[model samples]
Target chain A: MALEQGDELPELSVTPDKYLTVRYAGASGDYNPIHIDEEFAKAVGLPSRILHGLYGMALVARAATEAGGGPASLARLGVQFRGMGLPEQEITVSGTVADAGEAVTTVHLEARQGENAIIREGVAELRR
Target chain B: MALSTDAVGTSYPPVLYAVGREKVREYALAVGETDPLHLDHEAARAAGYADLVAPPMFTVVYSAPAIGPALFDPVVGIDFARMVHGGQAFSWGPLVVAGDEVTTTVTVKSIEEKKGLGFFVFESVSANQEGHTVCVGTWTNIVRGL
Candidate 1:
């Protein structure tokens, strides 16, 4: 089903774990130890090996894009990383269309771990 | 060791990074962004974009790479590898379409040290081949004492 304006997607969840961390590092060439190795992360004062903010944003974007339509549909995808998403908490991603025109659609996205949003004020623009 | 506030005015010249369709697609895939505008050139043209435009944040990776040397320069005092990416913000100007040759200039905005914690901000402005500003981003990194 094509997502129209004011549409909200079903809940999708992701957990930040070691395997996902490795894939993110390999894919993006961002091998910051704070994201992959716990000992190194602790040495630097992080609570634990944490998920890359972009990785979480990717999950949210994936849902928004899929729901909106397909690859050639999006015109813009923007997100601001708010709080750290940890391995222990499972984050749920969802979106609502903010506006729509004849051939264009805008989506508002958010990823929450429990009630707290780790990503805030995300938007995706898609062409219909 | 802490970041030098004096580093604020340093400017890093632009570097060429050929944007690959696969990279854009992979990034789109990784983020679960299936926007056809990012994957199909024809679809992008139909939508009024020249070619496959990327996710709004994609260019940051290329431009941020331009600051790699400054972030690691020993004289800069901060250990780039050990630092954490505290945050990032972007203000979009003109749209960044695919196949556009772009130049990015990076400058350090400020450095602050307090209570044994050091924070630094770096900003980059990316322009199209025609010198249109595509986006401006500020990245904050926080470092802890070793």
Candidate 2:
């Protein structure tokens, strides 16, 4: 794929299962109760046990890598958690090539759950 | 309790982590990454990586320990119960391959109290055994008042 500004990268969508949250907690060593305990999440005023923001960020990073060519191609990524991600909902990761230079390609990324944008102000730079 | 801005600029000693192929693969699986470069050693090598390539976000797995001291510091007065992950950012250097022993040094980048909320920022740098930087991560957390 020839890199160019405004080109949409391939979209990556994932539905995070309830069980996957537990697995991610164990794998990432981020055992925050809000991510694994539904009751705790409610007590904290959340709708439910929300997925870890990094989990969603990781998916976005993967999309960037896939778009840029490989894992080694990713050089920078940034995301701000705007909304909560509930388990079992489909989250879509998409991006557009913001800049295509000879040495790198910058991508403006976004992750959405249906109509709500869970991650905003997302950006990634990939080595060309 | 308000987080003390006085704790800003505190730095923690480096923590060592041994990067394993299985650990990387497990994280990739948990994140729903199906790329062969993250799971298969042969595929990784074919793709020009030394071994199974870790996802860029995989740095969080190894570097989380480095930020523990600041997050739990008694002086900081961070209420774990009220805290939530606010955001994350990353800058990568060389690719982290399996068998690389990395050390992460964490520092408290900033702390602020505003509008009945506390904001904390932590910066962590992970370097390989050869002293080459693997990644730099910035983690931000927001703590709400009870």
Tell me the native contact fraction for each prediction.
0.15, 0.88
In model 1, the runs with Cα more than 4 Å from the true position are A1-19, A34-49, A57-83, A86-89, A93-110, A115-117, A120-128, B1-3, B80-82, B114-116
* Per-residue lDDT of candidate 1, residues B1-146 (tens digit): 53567777788778765666667666655554556877777888898877777766575555757768667755556876556666665655565666777677888888888677787778878887788787677777778784
* TM-score of every candidate relative to the true structure: 0.70, 0.94
Query: Quick one: best DockQ, which candidate?
Result: 2
* Residue B26 displacement in candidate 2 (angstroms): 0.8
Candidate 1 on A22-90: residue-level lDDT in tens? 666666768877878989979977788877887776676567656766544555666767677777578
Please list, in the order the candidates appear, how each scores on TM-score for chain B only. Answer: 0.88, 0.94
| lDDT per residue (tens digit) for residues A13-124 in model 2 | 8998868899999889989888899899899788999988888898899899888888888999999998888899999998998899999899999999998898888989
Instruction: Estimate, for each residue in B1-146, the C-alpha lDDT of model 2 and write its tens digit.
Output: 64567878888899999999999999989997888988899999998888998888999988988889878987767887778788889999999999999999998898887788788899999999999999999989889983
For all candidates, the clash counts are: 9, 0
* Candidate 1 chain A, run of 10 with poorest lDDT: A68-77
Candidate 2 Cα misplacement greater than 4 A, ranges: B1-3, B114-116
Please list all clashing residue pairs in model 2, or write none if there are none.
none
Per lDDT, the best of the predicted structures is 2
